[model samples]
Target chain A: MSRRLAEAFAPGSVAAQVAAADWRAATRVAGELLVASGRTTPAYTEDIIQMLEELGPYQVIAPGIALLHARPSEAVLTTGLSLAVLEKPVEFGSKANDPVRLVFGLAAQHHDSHIEVLAETANKLSSPRFVNSLLTIHSESDFQRLLSDS
Target chain B: MKILAVCGAGVGTSVLLKMNAEKALRTLDLEAEVVAMNLANALEVQDAQVILTTPDLVAKLEGTRSEVIAIEGIFDLNEIGEKLEKALG
Candidate 1:
């Protein structure tokens, strides 16, 4: 586990049932969570938006989760992750996976520096238990428990 | 068998899929080199037997020579592994 990743997904990173009408709003909320935590600059958020505009909305990797991110760049302050669950599910143009409920926004400083963190997240996400926890967690402490236990 | 897990960005989504691919391979007791590549570099996968990716990105490989298997439930290891077994067979 990267120390940077630990800080990024730390206690305060989880937001419960944010109101987002669409992918743009959901992504904005997730990016704002990271920005509020000082993990990424405003430029990082804009970069994510720009990437989506340039490349379509293909970030929804799983059925309910979308891993929102841009490439490693100067816009990032530190490698980190922030997750937001939406009150209403939003579509991100995924054919197999739509109405994504969770957005995990990530920012890395280097291209491959986040492989370990990505791998860890991938491992945890495979579990129905953990993913279910993300959907049900109601408080910051609940989020923290899921983060550490998973 | 040479497999390629592809996504929009080489480093982000591809990396996660690569890890899952590797785990699926291990669980199935199979041996293969799984390389993660971005859409731009997807054309370089001529030597690859199966290309695993999402549905949106699969269209980008419509004319490609390699076999494209669009993964359903992209985050589920069991589903991905089952698809891998079918593809490998």
Candidate 2:
């Protein structure tokens, strides 16, 4: 069976309406939350940045959404998810999916781990209505509600 | 038939794409051994018939024998299905 988003979500890892000047800063915000939640080390953030700089921003999976991650390493404490919603959208240099506002930082212990949560996330984010609700959420509780939605 | 799902790190989005590709293949009434691997490893794969990845990753796959297809939306099953259909046809 597929896992729910909440199953892999890190506790207190949600940051709402973060003021980020650029996509890097927005990714940093998400990474920090992941670090604070004990899901990953600070090095994971730099790894993600390096991956983007070296390979490109293919992590911008859809319109206004970006999923930040790197290869599974010692930096990742476990498989967990963190979220950061920007106060204003920023570009990740992807021509097709640009002006990203929602950033999800994922730290997986293995290559195949967390597939269920990732699928759940993909299913939800693929819907425009769910994306809009996540973008417009006013509080962390509201965000939780949206994330926990089946 | 074989399909390769690729990304910068084989661990993240490639797995997402791999999952969707399997679903797309089922929707298209097809079958293939879909594998997700990092760019470095993917460069060494000589058996796959198709490689699914984002557009930016396409330029790096020049010497590979597989037909590279760039998918814009990793989560969009319909897009994946359509692209796989066209590629298979």
Candidate 3:
């Protein structure tokens, strides 16, 4: 059951790139990637941007972790997940855990159905070993292996 | 008992918090219905005895009659349960 959810990270399919200084730029890049992957539409892409604008810099759980989300309205064409590793960590008001280097953006349509997936992702990301692995990962295959073994 | 868990999307962390809070309440033998919703949906969800959310959203919930419990660490189950118990009591 755990592996079923973990397998969502496609080894070679995971696209990674160094983001510019701005967080919004990074979100747009991820949104574009999702659209390119056929996970969402152009309209949905704009919705993701609006969501970040309205609810963003979600530093409430800050200090290295930010959970970026939006309403399940016109923005989400389908349930999707994507990751962005900032070249330089950015601050989102997480004083206790400032400077977040990794961002895992989640989009979903249902309320409670995706809870298990988010919980699993949070548990995996919260681990020191897992995060360290992500930092060192150079290829999509490496990333997928990390999820597989996690 | 009904509890409203609010966050940015009402889809991600808030839902997780709701799950953890529900588990905690169940451990205490408290019967409750946890409804996860966004801050925009807060006005629609009436009859909730307590509100669980981050400090930012809680601030916007000012002047409302609902008992508000501002949870700093949404992932910390202990803090969430403690705040929930105090607010709902």
Candidate 4:
């Protein structure tokens, strides 16, 4: 069976109230979680940063969420997800979606393996109740339960 | 009708845009085929009636025959639907 959004979450990757100095810092935190989960190498983090430099703030996909990622590369050992809820929102320079508080780091080994989770996440985020729950997530368990709920 | 969702990498954000655009079209009761692709591939497609992409990528699609719509957020269904309605009408 294909991994769902909740199943694709790397162990110990969900965090709450993380402190980040800026958008780069926020992305780094998410990348670190992906590293700790054994999903990608340290180089994958830099790849994501490089993508940001090249692509601009297009990762800021919603009002308060930034989905950080790059094209699937060898740096990705396996597909996984890292989520962080910022203690203080940071600007990613997107005019429509500035002051992002939630960052999701995605590392996919292929073009399509992770699409299910991505689509699931997008659908859940469209719900105001789900967004509210995400903003108030107090623990990793809270985040996991939130994902499973929807 | 066809719509192309364009992004830098094609495989990531554009997929999200394509999904939301599908939902928006469904709500609007409009029928169209939406495809997700990278910037380079999007530029080559000639039959698409509309192209949905981020604000930054709007400039990159300068000469495409399709009408380009710049969406503020890929997940914002209301924004996508409103823009699609105006563009299609």
Candidate 5:
């Protein structure tokens, strides 16, 4: 079965609070999406935050993009992928690539499964068209449709 | 041969690039071990004949002795394979 990616947006949701300079805020927002979408539990949110805190800032990835993820057992309730487009980009280490407006969060039951999905999503994101479409998407439905089409 | 693919977190783009590289190597009649890792662990992973990553990361990894291919776009398997062929040869 194809795992359908979901979107979660709430007023004052973490996704909306991310600033171009706040990496921690972006991670929190990503965690909120996981919890709201039923992909994770409330208790696991702290674990996600911890991973970001320990591995975040510089020397992780570039600045503009934040690859927020956790070990399979720490928080993933299922196998799925999700995306969040920040109204403003945030930083996550990579100085050359900071101020990221797009946050792609991944969760899987195991290592192999996580890698498989990551490979597919990465291939898709490499496409300029796909990246452009993702940036312009305005709603959860739009995001869902993009995943479905892929 | 073993090729270690690297990116920011060893979770997103790097893993994806590993998948693409595996597929491309098969078509090229090349047998290889493709593994993904965070940039921090690249030096730790011995036996990597080649290191594949984005241009931004590649720039940071300059002056390395290992063969390095800076993929402008990791999603494009064709481009990735072409680059691999050049590096592998």
Candidate 6:
């Protein structure tokens, strides 16, 4: 996963200390990362937002973090990710974790044998040290470094 | 024995949970087939003994033979392991 997933969290995939009035804005910004990276189309970003509206903030899988994504569709061209850290956390109406600080936008395909990719990404985000640094991270290199060290 | 890890999107979180479940099961020194499936298709997998998921998604499966384990923090492996320990104890 270290070498294979490096492209997912590539240099331009990070946005730090962004200011958004609410979670919707926050999510839109985060989802757009996939579009900018050419991993997914804008429609996929809309799918992510629509998923939130239809299913609630179920993507807020952990405290202070939300992993945004939808099912595989024509909107997704490849497996990639975009990450965003907020200046001020916004509530996504999650019962367990209300305010989210870190948002990971995911676009995964069925092929490339990406089972390891999902596992590694989930493990890295859940690790205590990585979560701590992920909140304070200001650069893509730092984010890459943590994933690399893991 | 079989354990199923489920999420709204079968491709992402469930796959991750499948790996995490493997780790937790290893720690418990228990052997079981672990499967990851999306919520929409999970109900069809009736052979699973236990189903793991987030609280909100658990509500989708109200009455079922399989034991449903819902976690507050879906990403926390410690919480996941502890809950599984208590349930499978």
DockQ of every candidate: 0.50, 0.74, 0.57, 0.63, 0.24, 0.53
Q: Per-residue lDDT tens digits of candidate 1, residues A1-150? A: 334445558556779978898888888888888888777888888888887777767788778888998877777887778889888899987777787998998877776777788877877777888888789877667777667665
Model 4 regions lying over 4 Å from their true place = A1-3
- What is the lDDT of every predicted structure here? 0.80, 0.88, 0.67, 0.88, 0.64, 0.80
Candidate 2 docks at the CAPRI level of: medium
Which model, 1 or 5, shows the larger TM-score? 1
Model 1, B1-89: lDDT tens per residue?
Answer: 89988877677787877888888989999999999877778886678888988766777777777889877665667888998899896
* TM-score, first chain, each model: 0.91, 0.94, 0.80, 0.94, 0.75, 0.91
DockQ-based CAPRI category assigned to the predicted complex of candidate 4: medium
Residue pairs with backbone atoms closer than 3 Å in model 1 (clashes):
none
TM-score of B-chain for each predicted structure, in order: 0.92, 0.96, 0.88, 0.97, 0.90, 0.89
Q: How well docked is model 3, in DockQ terms?
A: 0.57
> Each candidate: fraction of true contacts kept?
0.52, 0.65, 0.54, 0.54, 0.22, 0.54
lDDT of 2 by residue, A1-150 (tens): 233567677667888888999878988998998998899999999999999998888999888888999889999998899989899999999898898999999998888787778877887777788888888877677777776663
lDDT of 4 by residue, B1-89 (tens): 99999988777789899999999999999999999888889999999999999998899899999999999878778999999999997
What's the TM-score of every candidate structure?
Answer: 0.83, 0.94, 0.86, 0.90, 0.66, 0.88
TM-score of chain B of 1: 0.92
CAPRI tier of model 3: medium
For candidate 6, the share of real interface contacts preserved is 0.54
Error of 2 at B17 (Å): 1.3
User: What tens-digit string does per-residue lDDT give for candidate 3 at B1-89?
Assistant: 88888877778767877877887787666788998887878866778888887766767677666788877776677787777777666
- Model 4 chain A: weakest 10-residue lDDT segment is A1-10
- Which pairs in model 4 have colliding backbones? none
lDDT (Cα, tens digit) per residue for candidate 6, span B1-89: 89888888777667767777778878988788888878878888778889998777888766766899986766566888888888777
Higher-ranked by lDDT: 5 or 6: 6
Model 5 - which docking category? acceptable
Task: Please give the distance, in angstroms, between residue B28's alpha carbon in candidate 3 and its true position after superposition.
Answer: 4.2
